[model samples]
Target: MFGLPRNRILKKKKDFQAVYSRGKSYANRFLVLYVFRSNGFQGKVGFAAGKKLGNAVKRNRVKRLLRESYRMNQGAIKEGVSLLFVGRKAAVDAGCQDLEKAFLALAKKAGIMAGDVEFSIEKRKNCR
Candidate 1:
């Protein structure tokens, strides 16, 4: 339940270019989200951290945090969209929860998430 399969991940230069060119974007202090909708079954996602963020280690760490944020809440996203998440400089020191909040807020603003969905990744046992 916590897996982001390879098929659902976007990793090609051309693919990233396509999304950037045709997508509508939403941004906040933490992230810039580029969203491109398609007529496919599963939506694809890509994460990016630029050199401005810092050294290689810092960049990769930000990317990993972004990936985990997306992975955990990916179930609430709509199908058939290409989502490119670019991390901002502020994200270098931000934690996963902060990133996740920024991501969901942007998705909500972009109308990319499933309608009226409660974004709870935790599975609570029934008290019955």
Candidate 2:
């Protein structure tokens, strides 16, 4: 029923801490991305939206948007990596497309995306 399995989600607090401590980070207006190379073949992802963003509903909404953006664009991301996406307060006002753009831009800046491919969200929409 689910495309992304449980293993693909970074669930442990230690894991998040490790990524935060060891990983490199990149940020835009919407989100902050922390990327760390992993030993596994598949990438693992985690999302964070703080209380500062708002109440639980608002935070969850931000998380949902971030997750959807990641799920859609995960194909273009490099394998063997751990990614943590922390949504900013501005993200509460951002749409999915804006979040996706922010995500991809940060991933590219972190050098975790393949350079040979042209990673454009617009092109991806037409292909689908």
- In model 1, the clashing pairs are none
Cα deviation of 113 in candidate 1 (Å)? 1.5
Tens digit of per-residue lDDT, candidate 1, span 1-128:
57988888888899888888888999999999999987642388889999999999999988888888888788788877889999999998887778888999999999988889867434323100
Model 1 / residue 121 / CA error / Å: 7.8
Please give the RMSD of candidate 1 to the true structure.
4.9
RMSD of each: 4.9, 3.5
- Candidates in order have lDDT scores of 0.84, 0.82
Model 2 gets an lDDT of 0.82
Instruction: Give the best candidate by lDDT.
Output: 1
